[model samples]
Target chain A: MSALVTGATGFLGRRLVRLLREDGLQVTCLVRPSSDIEPLRQAVGDALWSGVDVRTVELMDENGCREALLGCSVVYHLAAGLSGSTSTLFLNSVIPTRRLMAASVSAGVQRFVLVSSLGVYGTQTLPPGTVLDERSPVDPHPHLRDPYTFSKVVQERVAWDAYKASGLPLVVVRPGVIIGPGRGVLSSRVGLRLGPLMVRMGGGQQLPYTYVDNCAAAVRQAGLAERAEGQVFNVVDDDLPTAKELLRLCRKAGAGVKSAWVPRPLVQPLAGAYEWYHHWSRGQLPGVITRYRTAAMWKPLQYVNDKAKAGLPWRPEVPFDEAFRRSLTIAPAIG
Target chain B: MTTSPSDMIRVALVGCGQIADAHLQEIRKIPSAETVAVCDVHQDFADQAAARFEVPRAFDDMQRMLSEASPDVVHLTTPAHTHCRLATELLQAGVHVYVEKPFTVDVREAEAVLEAAHAEDRSVCLGHDQLFDPSWVQCRAMVQAGAVGDVTHVESVLGYPFSGQFGRQVATDRNHWVRKLPGGLFQNTISHPLYRITEFLTDDRPALHANWFAGSADVSIPTELVAHFRGEQVTGNLLFSTRIEPQRITRVYGTHGALEVDLDAQLVRRSRQNRLPGAFEKLEMPLRHCREATGNLCRNVWRFLKSDIHYFAGMRCLFEEFYASVRSGSPPPIPYEGMLRVTRLMEAMFEQCREREEAGDTAPRHSQERIKVESDHTIKSDQRSNQRPVTTNRDESRELQEAWS
Candidate 1:
């Protein structure tokens, strides 16, 4: 099989590209013109570089993307704008993805796997302790969330819209925070780093973490699996640690952290108060904490990857402790 | 001097860019303003915009649009470099002009445009719509009402995202129009923070010192600016940063209190002196914050229900005021003096930046110096030859379990 991967230079993208190559597939890496591919070359090493084809094409350039996708049967699109203003995020991420979807349909690709984020779920509105699975609805009002999450929600919407309209083979893999070497272990899921102080929202909430290699494998499986078409999979590793346990592990690993814990019950009210203050003060302090965002981040919920495990027939190869150890061996932060 | 309510103001738009859509959308909301024509150098864009907005006419040539459409008012949403000539031509053709921000390339061009408007007896408005945001309007009203006492200082900080479409275009494309401007990337946006400062500073020529440098390694053109202006009694600072979290806020400090306006969020907040004594003040502050926040939440909910909340609410308000001015033959929404002052300030800052660029002194110095200082300090402080290595790499999972035990 020949596969094309966008964002093949990113942390997770590099891993996915390598894994796809290892599975005896001819891999074509679609990178932006300005993207630095040296890191990708280093990650793939000198030996495996023979089978990998690198194509410099902007996703917004429909003709270029169509040309790049000419021989590729499967496409793994992982490129997205992580942060920006709403319009910026929409233009950079959503609009390009829409164009790519159009180009993919035109190219007659077999399968198009979209790597989305678990943050797209409308979990805050759900009752606490609800099992957040593939069936969970995405954010209804994405504009109320941060620009990054808002863009992702819209990107998924457009992907589904394409799927419904053109019968494009689509599979969405919503991965949790991917942690590995070079990338830090900390994420907003654990706590927000507000300057020197970390505001750890709640302790009992499970940190839905998928090690980068494990996430890449699941994404590969999603593209290859026949059952994954027209399905959404939540890619999360088993034996996840709670936010407190993760913080404790970090502290034990000689990473000094100063944290203030907010109890689970008080999290929502505190966020409301914080949102109120942030808005009332005309953003005197950064509007990092808002009621909607806090609810989305800290709400106590259970994550299930049963659909992914069953449909993709995949299991996380790396144990949580082993993954944590490998992550800490190179970097202190894991996210 | 005024048109009847039944009479509509025929409006044409030039440069069918991203902002042209905003102008057209807001114009459509007002029954008094009729979008008669849309024009762009790119004829396809003009046609697309006209079709999308249901405008009657689309033309690639400005002269043809003006002559054929006969629009009473023309919105100049073209590039800043083209703004001066376009505004001048539009005014000479007996039409009022509304130019987008960074009104012109420099004060000279701004003067020429204003001169043309004066000669034609037509009103001209710059797109300084942030000042017209409901939050900012309320903040200004509070300041005028002495709620914030006498203004002493103003700090305007704008956080731009280099990953944004405009930023990417400017950074990647060397020949992009924004790169050709006097201030390069900063010229396109520095006007926002500058005008916010001038609203309170009210000084045409303030003692100014500006530092411009690229905070990120992506582009060479300056993306970060820290400008200080001392306006006789009040001191103002403008921070335009592309590397930070995106925000648009202006803070005004006064004798008794301070007020901040978050134009993006459309919220206004103030800080007053705490009268409580001792550690109780610390507890009092959060409670007060909650109270103020709750109040804003209630008000915002009301506004949202009333459909008064939107990304382009400020632009809509500005359009209404500008259109009203045009109909009544009154002065434009923004005073000519204020526009001139903002343009002059921008010219001064850009001049300093250009000088620094020519001197080859625009690169950020602190990071390089800090790296050197840290390396030297590390070399000087290494005196642990006899010390044993710290055993900090124990199995954290086991340690975490034991801590619970």
Candidate 2:
């Protein structure tokens, strides 16, 4: 199968493009005009890079997107704006997806795989340990969340709208926070980074993490598998470590991370206090630890990947311990 | 509380959303104004607002509330597009109107609303509240009194935080009313800065040039804007940015000195050439700045003690002025001519930006070229001085490390 991959220069996109090229697919890498492709070329090596058709096209260019999408049966859209103002996020993330979907449908692409985030799910109000599967509803009030999550929610909505409107075969893969080399284990799930101190919210909550390589593998399978069309897959590794255990492992590896742990029971009240102070002080303090954000990020919920295992018929190749070790080896030791 | 029921102005409010809280709270502070009825398309919002503010009645329909409560003045706090239609209707119903700004979508809508107000012989006020802040009042007084002689130039900067309630709502919703505006989110907010310029640059039609850019990867609409206005007498520059730290300030430069009014801090300062000779001038300037800072600090503390240092202090001043004008049969606090002038200038500015965007030239190509020129000059300078090569790579590496962390 031939595939067109956007965000091919990103951390996860590089591995995904490499895996697809190895599988002998004619892959066309769509990149932004201002993107630096040297790192991607180095990651894939000169031999594979030479074979890959690299196209620098703006996602907003409808005609260019259609032309680049031609002859590619499957498209993997992994590009997303991680942080920006609301307008920036929408323009960068959501508008491009809408345009790309239109182009994909016009170019007769068979399946479009959208790489979304697990953060799009509205699990704040759900009881603890609730099995958050593919059937769980997306955030209805995404505007209340961070701009990145809001954009992802809107982008996913646009993709699904395209699927329903144009009959463009679609399979979405919502991966948990992708962690590997170049990215450390410290995530929002663990705590807020208040200057140098990491205010770890709760320790017992399991971190929903997917190794970049494993995520890439599942994404590749999502494009190739016969039963994957019209399905949503949550890509998460089988074994996971709680926030406390991850911190323990990091310290054991001689990464002296600065952290203060808030017990699980005290998380809500502390967040309430922060929120109250944020409002009472007339925004002198940043509204980073609101009850809504705290509930969304630090909630103790069970994430199920049964749909991905059955639908894509894929498994995470790298074990959690092996992935953790690989990631820490390259990451700078926390000061 | 001071005014009797018969003498008080019966005020009704439309659009009981986030900004309505500020309106109601400020109106309550004015004894002459009583919020009689509140209305919203969302019944829950109207009901909640009524309960919170202790308004007499609430209505989902504005027309019903207008007829039953019979308010003397109405605050049209609805969305921008709805302003022209609603304001005209309210005027025809024999009620004065106070519109939350971006008074109407375009110059044509603004003119129509103004005409309707004239025909009905009822006063209309545009919510250019920032100009009424104590700091701005002081700055304007200084300019009029020739502290800053013959206002030659003006600069206004309005920095919006996208994380704020209104910004978040617009940013997250694709079909938001703001996105439908001619200049997108800029249309809704550019007025505040533009109005400040219009106060000095009173030319009905200014030669305008604007450059709009997305600035960041996350927004498609122009979040950063730089516009220039060359009026009949004064030159003006406006910087409306979302990426910067939130601030609202305006600086006016005249022949004698410059005045800067920091709206957020409710502080005003003046800059002029030092009178002291040579080396003593340097010391004198710092001492003067220190004295000015101390004075401003004291003033702010006093205002805070009097419970006047508020996010909506300017709005409170605006409300008091408008209500006083209404009661005394004076022209509206914000003149229709000034409102129309700003709206007209805004139209021209947004049009210039739209034309540029349509030409497919939204990228920061100018900055790129400037960087190239500067780098070439630096390389030549370094060779001439026999110094080590410039350290661009180290800065890039450090930036990358910071981003990674």
Per DockQ, the best of the predicted structures is 1
lDDT of 2 by residue, B15-73 (tens): 87667877987798777888999998755457556765689899999889999999999
Chain A TM-scores, candidates in order: 0.96, 0.97
**Model 1 agreement with the true structure over A1-335: per-residue lDDT tens digits:** 79999999999999888888788898999887678899888888788889999998878789999998998999999999876445446656787898899999999999999999999999878998899998888988666677788778878988999999999999999999988877767788987787877778888899999999999999999999986788999999999998899889989988778889888778878878878865554334445677888889888789888988999978999988988888888874544
For model 2, report DockQ. Answer: 0.03
Clashes of each: 7, 6
Range of the 10 consecutive residues with the lowest summed lDDT in candidate 1 chain A: A278-287
DockQ for all models: 0.04, 0.03
Evaluated at residue A161, the lDDT of candidate 1 is 93
How well does candidate 2 score on lDDT at residue B74? 96
**TM-score of each candidate structure, all chains considered together:** 0.63, 0.63
Worst lDDT run of 10 residues, candidate 2 chain A, spans: A278-287
Interface Cα RMSD for candidate 1? 9.4
lDDT of 1 at B79: 84
The window of 10 residues in a row where model 2 chain B has the poorest summed lDDT is: B396-405
Give the per-residue lDDT digits (tens) of candidate 2, residues A62-173: 9999999889999999988887455456657887898899999999898899999999999888888888889888888776677688779888988998999989999999
